[model samples]
Target: MARFTDDNDADAEIRALGEALAMLRRERGLSQAEAGQRLGMTSQGWGLYEAGKRSGLFRPDVQRRLTGALDATPEDLALLVRASSTPSALTQPFKPDGLEMRGRIFEGAPSVERRRLQLSSDELAPWAAAGTVLEYVPGRWPRRDQGCVIEMADGSLRARLYVRSDEVELVVRGAGALLTIEKIPRVQARAVSAVVARLDEG
Candidate 1:
């Protein structure tokens, strides 16, 4: 009886972790296939982890590798699980600017507006090649070295790697031997969206 109880507890924990992982991936605007591609794995392999069928997920190193691929930490997963269990956290009505809410029936679902773009030039090459499709989330800030798409006031879209930003200017890197800095003034950019995944054509 004791052994059965222990097995049930472990199963429950694994399921909770899987749910957190799925939530984090969705929050980053990545589908299972996209997330799997980042880790050089198939979507089915990644799905096993979320289905609580991959026992290796309990390993510390495995947890780090899986979560790191999502740009999240193991600690973040734990916190998410705890927060999800709290009723107030689910009922919170906070909504971010420039984000459109969907699936109103499902409370606490991430309010993300994902956009797609195809590269027409090698300006962001090696990191992203021409013909590559990029999935980006609008209103999400990009971390250093991450890809970003800047929408100009004139309706042109510029794809570059994020370098840094200030109140006045946003610094980005274009294709070059040197890490060239292309600065765009805040007023010129209508929106700066983070590129979450790059899908290269076969």
Candidate 2:
């Protein structure tokens, strides 16, 4: 892994801000669609933004929305822009196969605490795609009724997990304030999980 040094502190700051946005989205336990709804965008739009695909463009309004959605301070987005434009010695480790890395994309390596997830269905589509990246952190579960990722006997779903009188209710979010819940069989609702962060190209 490459090191972030003081000489390139400005660029480091920019990269860190992107990482922070990735973290906030995961912590909220929201799919891209859900997150987009909050930001007045479609899930696909949010996906493009999060994927770091919209570089070399400036949209103040979108930036403001993103800042609010990500809980970032006012100037944080500016720093991200600067870092995105700056060239630094730090680069994504090159694969020996000689293939080129993607351009204008985020490039952070994965840490032990982070693991990637791919959406498998349109059941959560618009909020998450059929193959979207979700980062999971394994540790202290969030409060009951909070969003979670669970692998039960039936299958896996990203829903809010609440414990009722001897039962675990998995609640799924729907479009336009709609929500659904199912009583998960103890045998099936095993291996419940929580999201901690998201992995991006950077």
Candidate 3:
């Protein structure tokens, strides 16, 4: 049994790949400044490559030299190259702050007595989605024929409210069906509020 003693051989393989390329440049006994001259990098920049910092490195040409200098088997060099190029997921911690909150809806409506809502995508299925921020603006008195958002008595839906002279109605455009609330008397028709803007869209 070939017992491996090094615990960090995997990590070392990656570092070895990086160092092997650097060693090839140095085997000519060339100073970093001399290597830098050939590679079009500053001496300090080349050192970052040897240290295995991802940003500063010889890049593609390093592969050419690794084959020559280390006589590294293609399979070995490939393993190192793969390890070097691929980032360790553990090294990058899950940083909530680092995440970008894009498509993030914010309530922009300014109202004195209005409540804002933040609902999940699942909460408002077929209507709103996750990251949907809603600003509940007080409804203006319903106009004759303009589109308005209104709350129902049971508060089942906040839909476009349409008004006729003697009839109150909510026109829901689905299944090619329309709902007319003409049964409710003008005196009893209650308009809770209207949605001024969709917070998610804005």
Pairs that collide, model 3: 121-129, 121-130, 139-194
In the range 85-178, model 1's lDDT, one tens digit per residue, is 6658666654559886655644566656888899888777666678998888888898777788899999999888899999999999985645
lDDT of model 1 at position 188: 97
Write model 2 residue lDDT over 1-202, tens digit each, in one string. 7654664664445445445455456665665776677768898887766565553113556667776775554467664454455446246443438676655655654544645666555444444445656666555354444445666575655544344424544444432223444565556666656665433332
TM-score of each: 0.58, 0.40, 0.26
- Candidate 1 accuracy as lDDT: 0.82
Candidate 3's TM-score reads 0.26
Q: Which ranking of candidates, highest lDDT first? A: 1, 2, 3
Q: Clashing pairs in model 2?
A: 33-127, 106-201, 106-202, 107-202, 108-202, 152-188, 153-188
**Candidate 1 steric clashes:** 0
Per residue, candidate 3 scores C-alpha lDDT tens digits across 114-134 of 545554434333334556544
Query: What C-alpha root-mean-square deviation, in Å, does candidate 2 show against the real structure?
Result: 12.1
Model 3: how far residue 136 lies from native, Å: 82
Model 2 segments more than 4 A misplaced: 1-23, 26-112, 140-147, 153-168, 173-179, 198-202
